[model samples]
Target chain A: MIKKMKIWQLPLMVICLVGFQLYSDVVLAHGERAQQAGIRMRTMYWWDVDVQPTTVKVGDIVTITGKFMPSSFWPEHLASSEVASFMNIGVPGPAFLRMHSYVNGTPMVRSTRFFRGKEYHFKVILKARQTGVPCASCCQC
Target chain B: MGYTDSVKDSDNQSHEDTSRSDVSQDSAISTPEQQRRIFRAFDWMLVPVASILLGGIVVFLVALTVGDWDYWQDWRDRRWWPLVTPVSLMVAPAVFTYFFWKYFRLPIAATSIMMGYMIAAWVSRYANFHLFADFPMAFVSPSNFIGMAIILDSVILLTRSFYLQGFIGAFLFGVVIYPLNWPAAAAFHTPLVWDGYIVTAADLMGFMYIRTAMPEYVRIIEESTLRTFGEAVTPLTAFFAGFLTILNYYLWVWIGSKLAVSRWATKLI
Candidate 1:
């Protein structure tokens, strides 16, 4: 009877392991959601964000255009954008190479000061270097 | 009956004494060869393990001190990278050089430790940066140090004095770092115009690859007025690094000497 029970246990364990593996969520990109809710809500607000030609082949160029407004009610604890800020893209590793970036038609190769409550239009040209579903988001540093 | 028992006991005692003597004779003859074999086995086991442990400690020290300077190619600037990396890296080799040379009379400590560090570092760069983070191998590859390590060991071997080793070997170790790594880094340093702004390929790559939490402003590259010198920046940084490396080498060697003192506890409670 003991021998029969042990034989059944092996199959049960294998089924459990396979089920877990199948249902588990895989992480392929950065966790922006891990940021504090207050920070996410109070910081810069993005709109008119668009990525053209959704599909891109290796060496193909993709253009991302967007507009963002710095919130008037910025968190007091956070550093003010007036001191120093840089417009950038948040992507996983080097999935795409940024060919060019512009803010209000001005080239953004270095940090620039941003006034609170000011709306800024931006454009970014990216060259695809690797094949992946890149999650690109505008970031202020 | 008593007489018979005594006679049997005497025979047993004689047999036991003869067996004991034979065993003693065998051990006495084989002791030196057995000891030699045991020591050989210990050397085979201990050397690699010790090297790996030392290598791990050195990597940890480097990670803490040098931090991002050695991690990313873009961080390998003419100023801080050239200055910081060699000085930080010299710690392990300098410390172990004193320990190994004084005790074992072996000048190969730096070479062996560096070999171990390179193996471990390459494995880590591949496993953590390339495979896990999906970064390109070229982007996250570690700098080569075997050539520098060999020179350090050779210095100690040639000049059996630590003072001379520090003056010559340590200075060379620091000065050569930039030149040694230049071939790999020169392509990245080539000037390119991106959107009417002059930037290096490394700068472009740094801007493109988004390190989630690391901000652009935090990067400490060559941003000073020293850029006016242009081509002279790297050599100036290397010479300064060499001077600092000599100081660091002597400091670590002194610490190593103190640690190498042969003191033992008489009893454990």
Candidate 2:
């Protein structure tokens, strides 16, 4: 094949090869980057995701922990802002599963309670979703 | 041979050969001046086109995710906040200026600023309809606020002054932003029906974030009512928004100018 190729086609061949390599690198990088930043899923209020492997394959469990404290505010305020004394635990928008979030060893569920300054903990199991880089600032998987 | 005969004339033939060789030599030697000229030309022309296109892209994405253009046929009642379209679109100009200043080191003045907003709005509108709404650009109409942003920007750019940029840019911003948003947003601008009592659209949009509740019903105003509010709200909206946007634009543009004059931050490395 090398002997059969035209001289003029050599640059084109090199360009095509380089393009494919760059694309694969981008795809691989995003997943690896996401795993490293997966700790972002832990909320400042409830849980803090501590340890995660540098690379995680599908069906692998990632531990997520949350420390809960005694309720210091009215329950009404906890449920709805209009009546509540507690800051909602669901403040940083919605939660993501293994990729975005794993709360107390489970996925994030919808609820409005802030164990005001209390200590409660949970673990998250990592589950594979789509392929891409997770934003450490916002979403991580 | 006639053409060749002229070239072969004795003294002239030598001169022609000399020039031809010069041309070949020159082709091998690329001048730095020529490269600079090419870069400068690209700076003036290509940069602006890219900037405008960037502006359009921002608007397009917002239109997609915010408007939920996919299910337009239903036009079911949705709370205004679900739309979360920024209360004003003036942020576009300021944001565009910031990006241009940060990345391109180019001063975005007057019409260019407005152009940014207009492009952003157009793109967002296109994106909203096509991506989310599942409609084409033609079917998804844009607001005259686009025209207003461009016009305001044009006037400021032409004047090349700050006060006019701030006052006029913001005024137009305040005036047109919401109105431009109203047509598509009207569907979602229903009054709050919280706890089973009907409340004004203003209440839900301003203070509450009822993320989970199902949309109840759309409020259908009669033709007369629509016309009445259209006449009344349009000018009022513009005036109020224009004031704020103008103040904001002034601050951002000044910041942009300052950034332009200041030296870039240096690192020890």
Candidate 3:
């Protein structure tokens, strides 16, 4: 019977809703088609990529080293001109934890005035939290 | 009504017509005291169903505003975000007001929507872990609308009018939200000097972290030349937000009242 629902039941219902959310946890993200045509490709030329120990169990650390040289082209609407920028490690999700990263022999903890045309050497260390295939996202926007 | 009409018209030749008429009329013309009791039962029914529907709506709206659009993060950085975000946000609350007015009335409607929105936000953040896998929970954190929701409900409770609720509630919500969020948002704004550049903790984190969904979001923080003026533009933006909220409130109130087609209090049951 769809009779009157009790006032007290509402509070209890909210409690249940929250309880459902608290128990299980995971994350899904976007990838691949993130950038515009020939934008990031034209701007950043990445080469000499190296990754060791591709397969690992929970909580295993892996090292990655790469270098990229920037081109002169920057997006018009997004670019604020010679502003502070940082070298970011692009990963899939909480499947792996980012421990630390270094760019050009400096800990990339802060933003720097990254010139338009410059070469950057980068190294990153990540710990695997969940056992799964290694997936990464490309950001050009 | 059915009993009275049947006894009076069709039972004219029946022997028991008089007794049937008396009983039917008595119930049809119910005493004021009995009517009061029936209405009171109807009121009790407000709680459960209101919560479920409102809560569902809240989750959808929260995902659109805080998670998908990343409005909060945008506010910290963009010059136009503070002004436009409220205008954008007003859309959900305004559309929601129609449901609030139609079925639930004042207190129950306002309270349900408010509480539901908060709960939904938290739940959406949680769902990423279990259902929407591969997206970091950090990218879509739980939003806090407790302040605005409370203020909105308080206005309707006190004034019992959508007019004042819109005029007062929207204004207060617009003015206070930025400050209420500041306690948590402050951590993001923490200043750091890196290689002769003054950047916030938030900007750096955004640059460092990788969320494939959000590659290059537009961010024009304090570095803009607009700060050259003596006073900051934040307050003006808040006021603009308030104005837009009011407009949205009026529209939603009109909508809620219109959808409130059923006058019978116990219709939902």
Candidate 4:
């Protein structure tokens, strides 16, 4: 009876593995998710994020537009945007090349300050260079 | 009892004295050939070990001082990168140069240390940045310093004067970095039009590689006023760097001399 059960265990494990591969969804997370919840919630509030033409062939341009407001309740422990801050896109690898990025129509080629409780609109144009399902998100540095 | 006993005592003392002298002679004696072989073995062991330790120190010093500038292609801008990299890099070479020249009269210290640094830097760039972090080799490649090192060493060899090395070699060390590295960097500086915006290839590469550190936070210090210098900004930056390097070189050489002080101990207490 012990020998019979051992022979069946391998097949059962194989079936479970195959079932998981077939049924499981691919869950992905951005680097920002690793930050503390308090910091993520209190630092900046992003809204109205829109990525146009989500699917594109190689060399096709994709536009990402968004607005964010520095939270009035921004944690005092964290650095203020006035010190050193930059708006950038978070993407997977070199899948897309950023052609232009602007904040309120001002070219953001260098680090700029963001005032607390002030709303800022941003636009980024990216040219796809590789084939991938890339989730584009805004990031601050 | 008196005469024969006295003669025997004298013989014993003489024999003891001769044996002591022979023991001392055996301990002190070594042929020139044997001495050379011993030194050769020491050199074989010491050279690699010292190179690695000094090279590691230089790499750490550079990383702590101006790491960001040297790490990425996009950060290698017109103003700060050219000025900061050479100045920061001069520390180890300056220290080692003084040490080697004062002790051995060998002018190859700068070249040897620089060579070790290059090896260590390349290995780190490959292992840490490229392979581990998944950054491209082109984006993370280190700048070439061997050429500048050769020039510095040559100046020391030719002039054999610390003042000349400070004035000529140190200046050349700073001024030559940009020009020496220009060939590798020029391609990355090529202009390209994307979405009606002018961007360099380096900038484009920086954008393509998504780093945790954003592009906007890059500490490139090319100012608008300096941009007016147009094609001459690089040369202007290089000259200023050379001046700073001269001052820095002398300071480090002084420090090196103090560190290289040797004293013999006559008394254990």
The candidate that wins on TM-score is 1
* Over 4 Å off, model 4: A1-43, A48-65, A71-85, A91-141, B1-30, B217-220, B223-230, B263-269
Give per-candidate clash totals. 0, 41, 11, 0
- Put down candidate 1 lDDT per residue, B60-83, tens digits, no spaces: 887888766777767677777788
C-alpha RMSD over true interface residues, each candidate: 5.5, 16.1, 6.5, 6.2
Give the DockQ (2 decimals) of all models.
Answer: 0.19, 0.02, 0.16, 0.11
Task: Give per-residue CA lDDT, model 3, range A61-113, as digits (tens).
Answer: 89899997765776553442267454556565556665666778776544445
lDDT of each: 0.77, 0.43, 0.59, 0.77
Measured over all alpha carbons after superposition, the RMSD of each candidate to the real structure, in angstroms, is: 15.2, 18.9, 12.9, 17.9
Off by over 4 Å in 2: A1-75, A78-141, B1-45, B56-88, B95-144, B178-234, B265-269
Q: Per-residue CA lDDT of candidate 4, range B110-225, in tens?
A: 88888888889999999999876668899999999899889889999999999999999999999988888888988888876544556687876775576654443343234211
Candidate 3 residue-wise lDDT, B100-196, digit = tens: 5444454445456657666666675668543455444454454456677678778877887778888998787776666766676666666665444
Q: Looking at candidate 2, what is the lDDT of residue B10?
A: 30
Cα lDDT, model 1, residue A17: 100
Candidate closest to the true structure, highest DockQ: 1
List the lowest-lDDT window of 10 residues for candidate 2 chain A.
Answer: A86-95
Second chain TM-score for model 4: 0.83
Candidate 4 C-alpha lDDT tens digits along A41-111: 98889999999998899999999999999888876655567666666677766667777788999876555
